[model samples]
Target: MNLKETQKKFHKTLSEIYPKSEIDTFFYWIVEDVLQLKRIDVSLNPDFEINEKDLKTIKSQMNRLQQNEPIQYILGHTEFYGMHFQVNPNVLIPRPETEDLVNWIVSDLKHQPKKHLLDIGTGSGRIAIALKKELPKCEISAFDISETALQMASENAKQNEVKINFVQQDILKLDSLPEDVDIMVSNPPYVRVLEKEQMCDNVLKFEPHQALFVKNNDALVFYRKIIELAITSSKCKTVYFEINQYLKEDLKKLIQPYDINKIEFRKDFRGNERMLKLLID
Candidate 1:
């Protein structure tokens, strides 16, 4: 069928699940990814006919979308920090707010001498690889407890053409931070179980839960461990985290015991407290 007709049916099938604008985005994203046609092409060629095989593929993806699967996972890739990274159920999809956290680190370290950076719980390796791309002289190492996540992260690093040391280790069990790491960054699981009602099904149902949630009573578990490790690291000078907006005060109290010289919180585009910077003394 024609692109316009297919999109109309797509919208109809998903109207009960997603809003009109989101359906439009999902349709166009699939078109661009599967059909190799740009949005403008679809607009100018409204009658553009999709082949039967491709149509079946598009319909299959629409079914998954109807089931509340994230489009990124359906497409097997996503764009972050101006680069594309492969994604799957193994890692959480990188969010735009996390880009702000990456920007904060890049802005501060861009002119500094070469430093080693470690990304704890580096899911898809978005933060570490982006930093290495922007600051080529810097060495980067990323570790996650899930071997599948580490494999995906390693592939993403290769796809981005950046060299990053990918390791498999649970952050909660690590004894010490890497000796040469000068800066550490993470967007670890900070969502409390109680907050699940506030999230969308596409996230809660499709994204890896272990990479997005913590126990309700211990929302700061990862932060607590990382901060304790960072403060004791001889070469680590600074740390950055993409945090949950609701836990800013809790995070503040959690960091109070660390030998920190400065602590700053930056809001994301939505004006929520989402990023944190800690300069270790």
Candidate 2:
């Protein structure tokens, strides 16, 4: 079918599952992914025909989308910090809010002399890869509990042509590191398991649960563990986390006794307190 016809059909299919705005975005992304053509190209070349094989593949992808599978996973890649990274069920798909966390950390690092940076739970290696790309002189280490995730992160580092020490280590059991880090960052499992009832099927069903949810009784378990590690094991001057919006005040209170230089809570595009940057004293 022609470009316009294909888009119309795709929009209709997606709108059945998601809002019109999201459906439009999915339509544009699917077209771009399959045709290697931008929206303007589709407009200027309305008669562009997709081959039968490509149409079938696109339709299959749409079916997955309808089932609430993230488009990044469906496409097998996602753009983060202006670079493409491979994503799959083995790793949690990167989010725009996490991009904000990365930007905040990178902005702070720009003024400081280069030093070691560590990313805990480096799923898909998005944050570490982006930091390594932007701050080429800085030493970087990334750790993940999942063997699958670390392998994907290693591949991502190779793909980005950036050298990062990818370690398969659980933060809960980490010992002393090889060197003192200047900064540490993590977007750990802040979503409590009890919160699953409120989460969308796109997340709860398709994303890796171990990377997303913590035990209900201890919503801040990962936070507590990582912060303790940062204070004891890491030589970093600063630490950061992508936080759950509901636990902003609680998190600040939890870490106050540790003598953190500044515990700043920043809002995301949605105006929710979604990131916390803690400067370690």
Candidate 3:
């Protein structure tokens, strides 16, 4: 089929499941991934032909898309912090809100002395790798509970040409971190299990559960553990977390007892208080 015809069919199928605008973007991304053509090229050459084999593969992906499968999972990559990251079901797809957290950390480091940074619960090593790329002089280490996730993170570190010490250790254990870490950052599993009912079926069904859900009653388990660990084990200059939007006030109160220098609640692009930057002297 011609590129235009294929995209038309794909959009119609996807629009039945998702909004038309989103489906159009999805169609563009799929065509780009399969054909290695830019969006402008697709537009300029709408009559570009698709081989039967290639057409079959694209059709299979369309079927998955219609089933509400995420486009990132289909394409096996995502763009974050101006870099492409390999993604899969083993790790949570990096979100734009997390990019704000990365930018905040990088901006704060501009005036501070270069020191070691540790990324706890570093799934796919997105934050750690991004920080290391931007601040090449800083020492970086990242830890994840899932071996598969750590492998992906390690690969990403290599892909980004940033050296990160990727360790497969649970942050809850808090046993593997080094002393005198100047900064500790984490985007942990803060989504309470009970909140799964509210999540889209695509997310709940496809994404890794271990990377997304914490116990309902112990929703702040990761934050509490990481905070305690930072207090006792880190001589860190700062601690940052991409927090759950609903718990901003509660998180602020939770960290009040500590010797925090500044607890800045920053909003994401959508203006939701999605990240907390804590400076500890």
Q: List all candidate RMSDs to the true structure.
A: 1.0, 1.8, 1.4
Model 3, poorest ten-residue lDDT window?
171-180
Name the weakest run of 10 consecutive residues (lDDT summed) in model 2: 174-183
Q: Residue-wise lDDT of candidate 3 within 1-281, one digit each (tens)? A: 99999988987777667888887788788888888888899899999999998899899999988777888999999999999899999999999889989998888786776779999888888999999988888999988989999999989988989999988887777653487587889998889887888999889889999988888777888888887777676476578899899988778778889877777788999999898877765
Q: Point out the higher-scoring one by lDDT: 1 or 2.
A: 1
- Say which prediction, candidate 1 or candidate 3, comes out ahead on TM-score: 1
All models: lDDT? 0.92, 0.86, 0.86
**Total clashing residue pairs per candidate?**
0, 0, 0
Estimate the TM-score for candidate 1: 0.98
Positional deviation of residue 194's Cα in model 3 after best superposition, in angstroms: 2.0
Residue pairs with colliding backbones in model 1 are none
lDDT of 1 at 228: 85
Expressed as tens digits, the lDDT of each residue in 1-281 for candidate 2 is 88888878878887768998888788789888887889888889989999998889888998999899998889989888898899999999988888888888888877788789989999999999999998888999999999999889988899989999998988888765555776788999888777889989888889999998887778888788777777775476678889999888789779978967787889988898999888777
Per-prediction TM-score, please? 0.98, 0.93, 0.96
Index of the highest-TM-score prediction: 1
